[model samples]
Target: MGYDEVARSVTERGELVLRRRTGTDGPAVLELRANGVFVMDTAEHSSEQALADAALASVEQPRRVLVGGLGLGFTLDRVLGDWRVEHCDVVEIEPALVEWMRDGTVPHGRQLLADRRARVIVADVATAVAEAGPASYDVVLLDVDNGPGQLVHDANAALYDVPFLHVVRRTLAPGGALVVWSAGPAPQLLADLEASFGHAEEQTHEVRLQERDEHYWLYVARPAAGRPEASAAG
Candidate 1:
């Protein structure tokens, strides 16, 4: 396989790198890396799509969906695939990342940005969760960082905490599901999810990428019945 430089930019979060890679066999692929960290590429993203599919599966006729971290628009695209999804609200922290999509830096970028149901917001996802009204959404999908153990940004760790999990629970509609994507297994995150929502489950996606098998984890949780009443006493 051969790699070529496409473009690079400096953003508020960190250095953003874009590249086009070509192999002896197969199509040229686009890559996005942030601060020397490998984010993802056009080559494969089954796990990302799984994040949406797994979350949406748990909800019935989900009309409003909240998506955190717009990585190459895979998760958002998957959410929009469902006819039942009426609106998809996406929160991305980096303006450059969104611009990369809007300006055609990525191949499938424009398609997602142009989707009528997609509402892209260039701001911290955590802030959006905190500001969301109670029972505002049917599903919340988050793929912010690598995982709690290996965060691309230190501030992202806050999203996995119990307090933020409570906020996520509070923002969801009754029986709403919150799905989080992690690079690998995160037992602590699972415990936090269960502690906040009172019920949680995980799904693992195993994929072969870059000639190696990788396992990713998705934690899905829903607030227990009468959770608000239970919280009132605590």
Candidate 2:
């Protein structure tokens, strides 16, 4: 067996990491904390596809959508593949990840980054939602971090909270949907969604990769047409 060149380093939080890039066909793999965490090679992207597919199922005639993370451009690519999606705004905090997509480090990055219908914003997903105009988007999909429970960054915790959920609800058009991708089950997050939205549901799926089998969750929430009945801190 053989492997490509590997670049190893530690993040600010002291998480040991590795990046492996094989031949032209291989996608870069990012390993966190020496646990072989989150392999994002180009072979398969069932989870990303699932995020887009699940969100699209609940939305009707969705024109504009906001994607919280741009990992491997798979979720964005899947959303752009839909003809119903006229415009997409992708927010990613890591400039390097955005540049990777632009420089072809990831396959299909160039095409998706340059598409007129898509706009990539390099900023925090929470701030982006807060600043968005009321009822501006038809769908909001969040795939940042592992999930509400296993957040990669501390700031992301607030995103799943009630106040942020309020902002997200305000940013969506009537009958619009908010979808979040989680590495594991988040019962508290689910309860928060129930308090803010008209209808909320959780979906679980299995992710099969070369090294291991992983289970993930997608929490779908929809805003009510009227105002929120109560306010709860996340």
Candidate 3:
């Protein structure tokens, strides 16, 4: 068995401790934990990449993308993999997390940051999304929390509510797609997305951890033709 050690730790805006762990196996087995909650690890990030893939696949010729959370940079790297992706605006709430990735605190962190089309924004994702103009992006990919069921912060609950989702809807261009990565199935979140988007679909990705199989959920939604604007206008 490999023993784990804290490689680095920092207290961010929310007063939560963000930590990077290194396992005995080597640097490849690094994990990011927030307030003792496992945010993500570099070991198996297939689900993160899957979130980007599934979202991009749903749209054609996605020019501008918004990724809400940097994590280990897996989702951002996957988004930049496709040539059709022109620009990606990544919003990560923790400046320390962003700096960690920039300063090589995590392996594979520089991949997406080096891409010309990638822009890393250290701010609250919800605020960034809400402030964006209408039809600003063709794809909005979110991997901000563990899931609605397991949030790193309680305040993140607002991001899954109807009102914030409405803001997300307006930020997407006509026919644009919104993809959210969840640690597990969140029925209420799905229901909210359906009500807000007029349509929602769930895709599950199986991840192998040691001897067991774990599943991650991705909820994809598209803005209903005129519903978003009409609701806000009315």
Candidate 4:
């Protein structure tokens, strides 16, 4: 009942809206929706942090990283927090989301983008990954869609397929790693990852939300030639 529309935009892709809900305590939470479907919120984001943490831990020197899907900037912020990281490039397809984050519409967006080492590119992640130079990044983290299943945007499904994955693998450095965040179990994704990267590990995380505990999946993969063990992360 206390939800206030913060920002709204319409594009050929879909309609995106940002809303803020005020409660009795704490800050008002911001929620983002696309075409009437819930995308992400500022409330629960442990899985987002895990995505970055997992990828960063897997690589030996994760100085350069590419993060797909900026969401609420949690993953990028988490990646930048590590002193060892020198630069991070975030590729997001939605210009509205990027604008919202940069103009302070998304609250913490400005501070997160203020980091000198962080760069945000307004372009489709799939295209960006494909066009990237070989061995360009030490880590690649994708939080683009809801995973292979329950896809809010049908076009994002290509991200899970083999072709795009191969491109992602090509974009990784020698010891680089990739971590994808899925809203639920994507069993077939493991096989796809194994096929693309030659190794895949699935992590089912129990996300503690305000009202309930939700399970999210994180798929970790290293390039085929590499079989290094990823360091454990919380």
Scored by TM-score, the top model is 1
lDDT of 4 by residue, 148-215 (tens): 89787899898898878888887888878999999889989899888778888999889876568889
Ranking by lDDT: 4, 1, 3, 2
When summed lDDT is taken over every stretch of 10 residues in candidate 4, the lowest stretch is: 225-234
Better of 2 and 4 by TM-score: 4
TM-score (all chains, Cα) for each model: 0.95, 0.85, 0.90, 0.93
lDDT of all predictions, in order shown? 0.86, 0.79, 0.82, 0.87
Q: On residues 94-167, what C-alpha lDDT tens digit does candidate 3 reach at each position? A: 88777777877665576658889999988889889878888899999989898888888888888888888888
| Regions of candidate 2 where Cα sits further than 4 Å from its true position | 1-18, 21-39, 225-234
Least well predicted 10-residue stretch by lDDT in candidate 3:
13-22
Per-residue alpha-carbon lDDT of model 2 for 62-135, expressed as tens digits?
Answer: 89999998877889999999999999999987676677679775556898899899999998898888789888
Candidate 3, position 177, lDDT: 91
User: Which lDDT tens digits does candidate 1 get at residues 41-87?
Assistant: 88888988889989999988689999999988898999999999999
RMSD in angstroms, candidate 3? 2.4
Count of clashing residue pairs in every prediction: 0, 0, 0, 0
Worst 10 residues of 2 by lDDT: 30-39
Which pairs clash in model 2? none
Best-to-worst ranking by TM-score: 1, 4, 3, 2
Backbone clash pairs for candidate 3 read none
Error of 4 at 16 (Å): 1.1
